[model samples]
Target: MSTQTQTETFVLHNRASPEPVVHEPAQEPEPELSPKWRYPKVLSAGMSFFVAGVNDGSLGSLIPYVIRSYGIGTDMVAVIAKRYGTTFAGWLVAALSNSTICQYLDLGPILAVGAALQILAHVLRTWMPPFGLYVVTFFLASLGQAYNDTHANTFVSSLRGAHRWLGFIHAMYMAGCLVSPFVATAVASANQDSQWALFYLFPLGLGVANLALLGVSFWDRMALAPKRRRHVAGMSGGVAAESSGKSALMEITVTLRTPGVWLLSLFFFFFLGATITAGGWMVEYLVNIRNGNVKDMGYVPAGFYGGGFLGRLILAEPTHRLGERRMIFIYAMLCVGLQLVFWLVPNIITEAVAVSLLGFFSGPFFATGISVGSKIFAPELRSSAIAFVFVLGQIGGSIFPALTGIIASRVGVQVLQPMLVGLLGAAGVSWLVLPKDAGLHRD
Candidate 1:
């Protein structure tokens, strides 16, 4: 054969038996950068809760001022104003957001709206509007809080070391609670003219700062349509892959139907009822029943929240190690003992100490509940489940305080002790009914 012919034949043979092309598994298109748990983002979220804590914690100390300024009684403030106006409205807005806008948007805008609402509410309070208008501020503030907190919680729950983060965020909340009383008390006390309206200035400033932090940390996710999971041709896995294609209504329905949801909600309902009742009414209870001075007893709620700060910080690891179920029951029993001491103790200082101890034991209940809920629900349904549980818990928070106020109006604030004991007992029982392994993977 000629050399040219041989070369052609060799080339053809090589061409016919082509080498295998090693396709590097098409590099997974770098995951559309989802918002992550950078320290700044975490701190901003924690600060949102801090703002909420300041609002909630100050209410107890300010209740006396509210009552006096508006010429309303405890029943009106607790039930009509706080329960319906603030707690109920706030949770309703939060529920609506979770079911609708949250499905379409990211955490940034939701938190911004929440912060704005709180600022508006505080502005109204600073003006000391008519009795009717004053109540509306509570509704706005609560709604804002619910919106900010619900999203912040869902975000934090998805991160590594979620338990510790949850505890830290809640501890920040308690820290806000601890600090708010001193400020609210001081502001309200310093104004002898009963113009405690100035106290709202403190939270107003915090609300603005909260809005600023959320804006900066979540800047990337601010746009509603862009941030949503878009299924690219190759990037199909992880959360986006598992993302439930179901409509928001369907997701909410599925979450509602879960037995674990109802059980957890029940536990939180009673738990929050006790918590809000103790914190909201303790000042009035001391002033009326124990003959505590208004100025001094105004700071009592701080003791309760202070204990909560310590408990969540100190007991988070223990609660996880010792078992959530076991630790909560023990805490309830301890709360009962402390309540008894508070009830029987005649001295104001002793009552204050007892109530503070009650707060300490009760502190871990909220963070632990969130930790457990995150573990139990399916990933897709987690947000709805948490929001449902939290809103229902807020309902309990509203109901018990309202009921206490009503009864106190008729009977006396002395009834707070018995009401707390009953609520705590109910919460413990509810916890018993939850399935041991309720998460989607377990089922």
Candidate 2:
């Protein structure tokens, strides 16, 4: 079929209502992943998240090790922060390219490319490459994550009961986080002579499995096809290419024009900043200030991730029922309160429990935001809008941690508390700032 025919069919299928597609008055209910074939695809998406969780989660536990082994920081943590700063470039590249790539590529091939890049990154890290190479791996891994996660989110949100599925996949990510500390800490601490970098081997193996699952599940759609000939309205050759380029550019323009997208992106921005900062630096803080053993403190982050796992599993339905706006703000405030407890209560056990509860409360923020954004944005723009949102979240995810490293290099790791309090409060306020309900976007 011609590109115009495809565009027209999209309109016919999607233009049924002026209101949001989720609430169609007197129409049939939204389709769930009733097709038996889709089960494996969802599983692949979850595995992809799990693989990412392993890659991202292990970094927190390994930070101390990465520092000591490489002599990254002596009096200050500048080198580590500089390393995280590189991840921003990867996410930026993905944000700038996502919409154009989506216009030209099929889903399966995009996912495949992402999976492959991640695997290559892990492979590069397995041998304990140089410091520069180690930092470069973050860029490759992050770029892969951007492609895989943005598309997976876009695909899953398009399904029925997206909240449940989004929670499931994200929870799987927490599960990976939960498990990674044990593995990473174990590998890094097996003996006094333990090679900290060897912990990457585990994710390398998992990345391989993830790629295999993606290839098998997405076999039918997997491809990097040649560009299509555009014959629409007598367009030919360079003119067709120019028109395609123009239309692709317009998608990004429309997504940017929507106020809801930026509002939603703000929520993710602060939410991720707090999360990555907490997870990435919690162990370092414990060791530096609390005088906790590095080995034991490494495992402490598991409590936070495990709480997040259970929270996403348990709270998804309740949040959906209680209302996204009201409940998310409450959860964000709860997170702030828990963060205070974690910060002020000097006891190690108290800090652990508080961080765990904080994770529990913040768990739904990601899936909930995706659910709302999926509904608010037009179907055509969902992929681009969410890609933009995900990138912004990542920008926070990278920035705050790097910033913390920069500040902590001088003042001390104790700065984590106030930074987190401010971020959590900001996140709560941002939630309140969003439209009170998803239904408001109908039309």
Candidate 3:
């Protein structure tokens, strides 16, 4: 009953029991290490941009050829232009659908939907429907393209090294653009009436392929990139505060309030409109105003898209290194000079080279805006912020392309030369409005 007697007996009972209760060091879970190569998802999403390039660029090549088959005047052919504008505008209004649906539905599936719609659009166009039916199908197709574009851009912004991804993805778009002219032109050369349908063959194949790739790549796509915590403002002074609520509306509100956002919007507004208008109409302009043949006009648009593709590839590094703002100024200046060349030059050789250079340099401006927006906005609100900015560019793409049709209808597509000059000039001026370091955020 003594304390020593009881303690000694108890110690002996379990002293050799259970293998001496091995003293193992507690294992700490390995720190969740990010992959050495960051942002493979953003790169995966860049494929969509390649799809877009094929769509836009090929369409430009087919426009004149389609005109001959439809037996429509410049004014009537202008309906196609109008539909593109409306489609983009509709998507702009519907931009929120992406973020909303993405919260539940997988983003990869949504991209598949877009590719499917685009393929459907091409099929419908290939069938050579009556004028009315043609317009309707194109609209449906464009809606899908818009969805893919908005979602891909938003998705890329969430990844690490979003700027590089943004540039590369957009460059792929230019690459598609570069190829479209050649593809459509070649097809048109072979078959006159329904030859435009041939252009769809490539897009259809690619779309399906891309959809399959998206399925395989979804796992990697869903992984979150490293992000810093958001800083909240408080009444006590500048200090860390509790996290703020997030929503598409809140993101839009925050982005809209920033002067940089609006200014960037305006910059895109003019540049996007100008680029789409110029590239879309350039072939028709050459055919109608300059008496160039369909094949030759086809080559002309290629110049622009070719330049654009190169610009995207080459400018990515320099722009990132030299600073986006400075690079933008240089691009704008180059665009202005190129537009002048297009306007003043009498020979096709001069005009072709100039247009290509113009497209090449101006390509950077749009990609730059997306990259900057990704940096300026918080990751939580990124989808909405990018959607807001993209809508502005879509509006520009819609409006200006339509305007080119109207102007080309009456005053002449030749007038586009001067208008492009003015628009590029305006974009240049607006680029300066962005405060230096506006796009730099250490996320």
Flag clash pairs in model 1. 90-143, 376-439
Query: Which scores higher on TM-score, 1 or 2?
Result: 2
State the lDDT of candidate 3 residue by residue for 191-225, as single tens digits: 54446666677887877776666666655333221
Cα RMSD, model 1? 14.1
- The residue-by-residue lDDT of candidate 2 on 91-146, one tens digit each, is 77887787667545667778888888899899988887888888888888888988
lDDT of 2: 0.76
Among all candidates shown, the one with the greatest lDDT: 2
Against the true structure, what is each candidate's TM-score?
0.87, 0.89, 0.81
Models ranked on TM-score: 2, 1, 3
lDDT of each: 0.75, 0.76, 0.64
Residue range 223-243, candidate 1, lDDT tens digits: 553324443234555554344
